[model samples]
Target: MHLKLIYSKKELYFLKSVFLSKVEHGGASQLCYAKHCKDVLDFSASLNPYPPDISWIPDMKLLLEYPDDSYYNLKKAIANTFGCPPEAVCVGNGSIEVIRTYFYATIEKNDFVRIDPHTFGEYSLSVQLAGGRCTVLDDVDSRVRIICNPNNPTGSILSSSELIEIARSLEESGKLLFIDEAFIDLADERQSMINKGISNVFVSRSLTKSFAVPGLRIGFGVGNPELIEKMEVIRPPWSVNAFAEDFAIKALENLDLLEKSCELIKKEKIWLYEQFERIGINYVPSAANYILLNIGADASLFSKKMLDKNIFVRDCTSFGLPRSIRVAVRTREENLILVEALEKCFQ
Candidate 1:
């Protein structure tokens, strides 16, 4: 009788089935595992809708050859933009590459802390690959959290005061804090931690997002010079291509372009938010370019339904939120298409 008093096992089987079925197609170019899909009003990626100023492309062609050791000129341009020394900036193919380097450099086996239910699946994969124990900070211990200013998937933004408090706790605890601000460019730069010179905080940035240059694959991580130096030691020789470095140097020169683009996006983001509010869909307020909405209990089904009509969106089921969907704002027309598609789905 005592042995037969346990709970039923059907729930265990269902959990196991869901876990086993979670597989991602990493190498595919298209969104949400779909190929050759048309009528794409993709709100999956947070990249800028506008292209970069290309007035200097012809002159930049000279840099199509090999790169120098220092990445001096490129570094100088970035330094000027961030108001840091050239050495403080460690560039990479993408900030993701820099993230891998940091995990290997700063963390050892049995030493990693993560804030639960966040983006960057690769971070967990990298941490495990490096033989580190991944511990998550739950709601109970909100002090030492590694927040994503405007968090991905859910798209909720923490206030600057909240972030500062967490940073202070991590500093007191002597733990590392990695803040991925890849989508922050879509918001007010004044609200960013980088602008505040927050210590003990390593901020990873991706030009691929706000510049619409995912093809170029350029990004950087800013932190203390000592940590950045260690990361640079682990970085492969010539990790960034000549073309990417060249393009980034020139892109930095035209800072006005990025500024103007962000303004345009801010306007579009407000309009898109209004539409979402009007539709009565539940969405977290975002300071980033994307919005995450709870599209009822059948989000995966709704996402597939939208894909059939050729509009791609990020289904957050993989991120442990089955009813949530994350969508990036593009042009006014593109956002309208998504609104129409979602209206049809709900109807």
Candidate 2:
């Protein structure tokens, strides 16, 4: 008798996915590497440079008693922040969860939608997991459209007018529109679709990225009340940990902190862009917290080179742009290190 080993294609692909997740573990910030260097200015993640209000962690006993089943207060806070009704608000473990729930709620199996090229990969993955189809749209209309405002790698943002026109068209066509505004906090608030009052549109916002509370894993979505109700049905219970909820509540209470952080990012982003220009390296202008750059060729190779020098940046190979890299806007000193290093590399 002969025995044969069996293997499945999905299993094989899963193994690859795990191996090629991100340049760092979910793109960990450079600041965490204090052991390797005295100064770690991580421009890898677009987060609040200012720390949370508390000098230390808060107690979590109250939160452990199981989250508010209805999440009433949480929804109310979100509504207050967005100047909308509580019914128009929905909560999730993170914005990505809300994104997945939204797709699963409406998209029929095998239906196709258009997404930005080399944008966030999770959107496509979520569609596939829901057994739906994805078709890329090239500056053309004719398919359901999803976009990441101030997009992921390049950080390019679609103007409010353009997005409004697109949303109007999609609404008239009876198609779904999902816009991940997780990074839009880095820009002026008026540039967002939320200000335009567009319906049939879902905007997923996260405190994780903006408030540097990623460990809390709390995010919310604002959209049509009917659509949010649909997602709530599919959303799971206790998806948000207790401490995460508390963190969000406290963070939202401090409007001054939010404003200060946003202003700093905008200023630093401009300075960082000028640094890149002065260095004579190739980079795309960004409205978000990070900049996408070209490192000659083979970004993975360039990233490794930086890492060897105790510096790190995001290689865009995962986004299917191997020659480009994305780095967050960090402190002046850290930005200088990156600029000097890249100038050396180019020379």
Best by TM-score: 2
Candidate 2 least-lDDT 10 residues:
20-29
Query: How high is the lDDT of residue 93 in model 1?
Result: 80
- For residues 240-301, what per-residue lDDT tens digits would candidate 1 score against the true structure? 88878877877777756677777777798889888888888888777777888888877789
Cα TM-score per model:
0.84, 0.86
Pull out the clashing pairs in model 2: 43-328
Task: Count the clashes in each prediction.
Answer: 1, 1
lDDT of 2 by residue, 87-169 (tens): 88888999888988988887765678788697888888777666566788545543358889979878888887888888898
Off by over 4 Å in 2: 1-26, 29-41, 51-57, 138-143
**lDDT winner:** 2
